[model samples]
Target: MIILYHPRATRPRSRRLPLAVLALAAALEGKEQYEIVDGNLEDDPTARILELIARHKIELLGVSAMPGPQMVAAMETSREIRRLHPHVPICWGGYFPSIYPDAALNARYVDFVVRGQGEDTLLELLDALRGNRSLDSVKGLSYKDMFGLRHDNGERPMKGPDEFPWSPFHRLPVEKYLGPSFFGKRTAVHHASIGCPFNCSFCGVHAAYGNKEKMESPERTVAILTHLVECYGADSVQFYDMNFFLREDHARELCDRMAHLNLRWWCEARVDIMSRYSDETFAAIKRAGCAMIFFGAESGSDWVLEEMQKGITTQQTLEIARRTRQFGIIPEFSFVIGNPNDPDRDTRETLRFIRKIKRINPDSEIIIQHYTPTPQPHDAGGEMYGKIEVPFPDSPAGWAAKEWMNFTLRIDTNAPWLKRRTKKLIDNFEIVVGSRWPTVQDIRAPRWSRIFLQVLSAWRYALHFYNFPFELHLANQFISLRKPKRESL
Candidate 1:
């Protein structure tokens, strides 16, 4: 038997389907026996894993992890599992391992690191484990040799979603993943594409996927979503693709196909790409029940955007904001402040740009994050951005430390370039703007609480005096104002 584990990543209420584990399970379907153990759904995933091992002749334990809190949980769980069942081979996959294979292997518990798309890599690794293939032949795999030295066997060619079987959703408790969201009473999530073509400096997409993206056929996408709606009663879906709208023709076809699903959806897109989209395509997207589009308007300063290798300009962001509003679809603009070069200037410009976005469309949602650098490979142009002198941790435990964990989440990066005063300004301004225009996506915040916050922050927001929002901070202590960056659709 094999076990696929999804380490706890978010709050239980925020947890959607474990698409990564399910994708691995799809590769194992009919050929091998495996069970999924999601830490998000279980109170004690380690104990449950031990129980499974005791009852079955387990062959391997694969853990899918991302950065931040999930990495912490994964390290702790894997360490305990190794302590109790040292013989069980443990493999790590997903964004964390893909980006930092050495750190993942540095943990004694992780025996293998599956790089890139793991569906094919995992199948090949399993074959190698069964003595049918050689470990060196397994592409997108990292394992220690007899001498205890690590070897990354290079990348595997990526395939489109159609190349693989649909996720083994039947094997999972699908109902448990359906939860309440502003979009619908029972919301589901799906990744209709693999990887992203853009190589943004602040992003780690290229680390795992390279500069490639392959989208599924609209028919295949709609069919799977239809099953979720009919069989699991999922009324809404949030596409987790890095860039959902690639081609205008593709978007038009997808929108046309999904119009009959009657499902409210949200997705991320590039502002420049969407700004170039025809009004008819926007209409189709809106008609298909697209409630919101999350755009990576990385910064307000054109110089900062260029520095980040983000091809979109601030004007394009504003144009999309105006365009999305015209189509009755909310534009959720996310900004990354505190650029390594002249962080103070970057922060001020981004904050001002966010306010400008709001002025263009009062319904626009703003998301702000501190500039947290991720390891990125040099692009085809031989350019790299967001490079810093700080040494990255060489072990999972080092990354799980409080400081690094915060860095992963982009809450407080502790980047050398960012100053305390700049951080405070960002924090205070965030509170004032967020309170002034409470997110429509936040169904949890009470009406009275929203009113109270709006009233308290009105003068501060109007005058742009966001120095010390003491009263807003105190009010937030009693009332949790959910930020768009932290919440899901």
Candidate 2:
């Protein structure tokens, strides 16, 4: 049996999550051989997919999608696969499908839609498929019957973080998968835990993992790290956890173990937690070979922070950034460009904040992201606006095919003013980079090659910036611009 996982679009280098690891775990459960064919990595033409299907006798195709264009790519790929090999069952799973299972299930190309925490559910579905049993018994799956779409009630609870399978780095061509920074150096990723405790409305973590926090035991986490270093010769291991250091004790213990291993690594942590950690603990973390840390410093405006329920004040975020630098650990701070309540004043304040931080800590790197609003199951006024709906087909096969294409556009037609202002803000903020940072010198290269690389990088950053505020603005406009005769939601 074969399980193919599609990563996001192939563009200017984006990191591929450990989908191979999850697919391996599911394959192990059913005692099936699996290979992760990244569509983005190798352009999958009709002939290529057909050749693989015939060679491996593939029984299942599982496609995963991130937001925006990737969703469309996934859907299109599923449709193509179905056209070539209709017998092979296709399953759609990921953020987009999970959020809009009903719409996804109704699509023409998807055979099954797995919502939320897919590891266990995927295994279960595969088992049933192997047995030639009815898919209705599969929990967390949406299928279509002769009548219409059939969604199984309730999602399977996510497995404990410890239960997650170890990285399948051994199976993948690690050298090919390595980032530019990993050319001669080894790189690996570890997930210390699953889910975040915070309920930031703009975040998808809460929607995907719920409000509960689940962490792997310190010993198990240490063992994983040890394996990565000893077996894989990992020079640097990136912690892929949404919030790696949520528990201070866990962070300290992991740091202690890491210190003994004497390996370089990086992790993401909340600013509030970092602020409360004792200097000794941070020192230990640095000793443990933590060379860098990324913080979600969403905004400089306190009001925006408060509105997002981020639980950290701008002052607290600044202090944490400062302290991390003081400890000699590289700090990469991320900021959101647009907020729901953002105005000209707020945008200027955020830019000023970015400038201040750059002045205070010359070593720190700032990553600015644009906001997009994804449709949640229960969003404010969502019900009145006819609940943000994706056009999912009723059949499992069709739903799987369309799963990736169903995303809310960045600008809703309903709010022209918001959309116009957002474009202006993005244009204005381009000035911030110029005013605050030294101009980047153009490197001499082949004319065609340099233009291609620059354009690619520009598009990559443009797509990465899409988040809630932008999506909401788009959705609102879409609703408002609809013909008056058309009913809402």
Best by TM-score: 1
Instruction: List the candidates' TM-scores in order.
Output: 0.97, 0.77
lDDT of 1 by residue, 1-489 (tens): 999999988898888999999999999999999999999999999999999999998889999988878888899999998999998999999988888888888889999999879999888888899999999999999998768898878679889999999898889899999999889999999998888888688788877886788999999999999999999999999999988999999999999999999999999999889999999999999999999999989899999999988998999999998998899998888888888888999998888888898899999988888877766422212123644555678889999888887787777888778889999999888888988888888788889998998899999988989987889889888888777787641
Q: Report the Cα lDDT for candidate 1.
A: 0.88
Clashing pairs in 1: none
lDDT at residue 319 of model 2 (Cα atoms): 88
**After superposition, candidate 2 runs with Cα above 4 Å error:** 11-17, 20-30, 40-48, 130-134, 182-184, 378-426, 434-489
Off by over 4 Å in 1: 377-387
TM-score of 2: 0.77
C-alpha local distance difference test of each model: 0.88, 0.62
| Residue 326 in model 1: lDDT | 94
Please name the candidate that would achieve the greatest lDDT relative to the true structure: 1
Q: Residues 12-68, candidate 2: write the lDDT tens digits.
A: 243444553354454454366776666556665345566778888787888776555
Residue 358 lDDT in model 2? Answer: 62
